[model samples]
Target: MKERIVVKIGSNVLTRKDGTLDVTRMSALVDQVAELHKEGIEVILVSSGAVASGKTELKIKDKLDTISARQLYSAVGQAKLINRYYDLFHQHRIVCGQVLATKEDFATRRHYLNQRNCMTVMLDNNVIPIVNENDTISVNELMFTDNDELSGLVAAMMGSHKLIILSNIDGIFDGDPNKSQSKVIREIDTQKDQIEEFIQSSKSTAGRGGMQTKYNIARKVAEEGIEVIIANGRKDNILIHLLKDKETLCTRFIPSTKGVSSVKKWIAHSEGFTKGEIHINEGAKDALLGEKAISLLPVGVTKVTGNFETDDIVRIIDESGKQIGIGRTSYNSQKANEIIGKNNKKAIIHYDYLYIEK
Candidate 1:
């Protein structure tokens, strides 16, 4: 099997000190991707440089709202961005396609599968797919946390063997980057609980994600049996070194041996898009969270809130309204409410469709 890898270029890595797009850096990264292409490695590039590209040439006369400015900038920048990629790949005698995605694209099973098929066909034809968020159309509260989150989704959806998140800094550190005592943590095994304390929550104004989001996305992607690497893209030939060298200065998240089902993987990323809430009793919560896989029965459901249709995504909550997981519901909100707290009924969410927090 051709090793499929997803590479996410962060805004910090693609943006120069002047906050403009770094054309030289961008070309260098594409060169490495082309190198990987020659070796028959299927690559998906999730890039973030549209806003910076917009800053390079355009100047707005009137002050605009944050969303409006972003929309305007993305509209102009995405065009220039893809054209550059198209030209660069063409120079290498490689064909590359652009895929602009929104959060809604992965909200449902059908949409998710449709995208997966499109990219699968592209890979089968040996075409590199350069993906980016549709920032021009994405609405507030509906947008992704950042491209890091998007890359993780794409990696899982495509069943990629590895996910490489490139940023400006080296990787997660024991202390602040400015401090002399800080050092890059080389490898992250299954000790995610111990690593949580090191992730700082401060976000960046440019890309909306920081080290914390990268770590969260890395952890989630690794849990899905995909190895994840967080490395400094500013360093020349970083991607090439990661594959060639035995030791690279990157934070590697070791993947889990257990495999996750396709439907469940889609459900895992649908936590933010659930249409309704299914509040279950303590018994059902315990059973679902237990080692043995258990379906969510209607008898354990105390309440069904919101207006969702059959097969829609729904969130499973505990008595205190804490989210336990998300799943594809077998019943609509009306029917689910009708059968709540009853016995010998059909499951509200089957085990196959349920994705619980680990």
Candidate 2:
């Protein structure tokens, strides 16, 4: 099998300082991807720049409400973005497809499988698929955290060997980017590294995601046995450089030693899409995290929060109000409330549908 990889380009990398789409940068990136395609490496691109592109094109001086502004900008910008991609890819005699996805697409097994199949067909036909969140319609709960999160899910779904995230900054820093001495961390072992201290909570001017979001998604995907690289997109021939040289100045996350099942990866990545939460006692938490594969019983549940139906994805919280994991519930909120701490126990979440977090 050929080496498959997913490449995510941030809005900061695709837009100029004036907030307009950077045609030169886009062409350069596309050229690199075209070269990789010629080398027989399957590439799926997850791009973020629609809102910025739309805002620049509309030139609206007055401020609009959040939802309306996003809708207007994304609605206008997505067309321009895809059209540019089409023209650029066509120049290299390569066909590219646009796939706009929402958070709801990964909510269930059927929907996830459908999306997986679509991407599979596109790749099998030697066509590159450009994926982006449906920002025009997504609002509040329906929205993905950012394209970083969306790309992670897409990479996992496609069973890609690697995920390459392109950002404006040169990977992750040890301290702060503003500081001159804060050196870039070149390698990250997800199983051993404590990276929380180095990550700062800051959003980009042109995009919703920050360095923290990238770190999180990178760590999550790495845990599922996928290599993740965070590098500077503005650097000349960045993708090509990474492929040709292993000594590139980029943050590389090593995959976990233990492999995760496809179903478990889906469940683990669906934390943002959970509908409700279940609070369990220490004993239940221990059993789930321990050697024996055990189902969540009604007797172990102390409290249930949020109204959710059967088969809805929910977070499993410990008694201390910390999230331990997530799973598909076999019982609804009402039924779960009735059966808490009783001798007549029923499986609230079956072992097959449960995934314990590390």
lDDT of each: 0.90, 0.92
> Any runs in candidate 1 off by more than 4 Å, and if so which?
none
Point to the candidate with the largest lDDT: 2
Give the per-residue lDDT digits (tens) of candidate 1, residues 1-358. Answer: 9999999999988887779888899999999999999998999999999988876778789899999989988999999999999999999999999999999999878899999999999999999999999999987877998999999999999999999999988888988877899988888886444687787677765688999889988988888899999999999999999888848898889998988987778888887788989999999999998999889998898889999999999988998889988899999888998999899998899999999887
**Candidate 1 clashing pairs?**
none
User: In angstroms, how far off is 275's CA in candidate 1?
Assistant: 1.2
Where does candidate 2 stray beyond 4 Å? Answer: 61-63, 342-346
Give the per-residue lDDT of model 2 (tens digit) for 115-230: 99999999999999999999988999999989999999999999899999999988999999889999899999987899899997999888898999999999999999999999
| Alpha carbon lDDT at 338, candidate 1 | 91
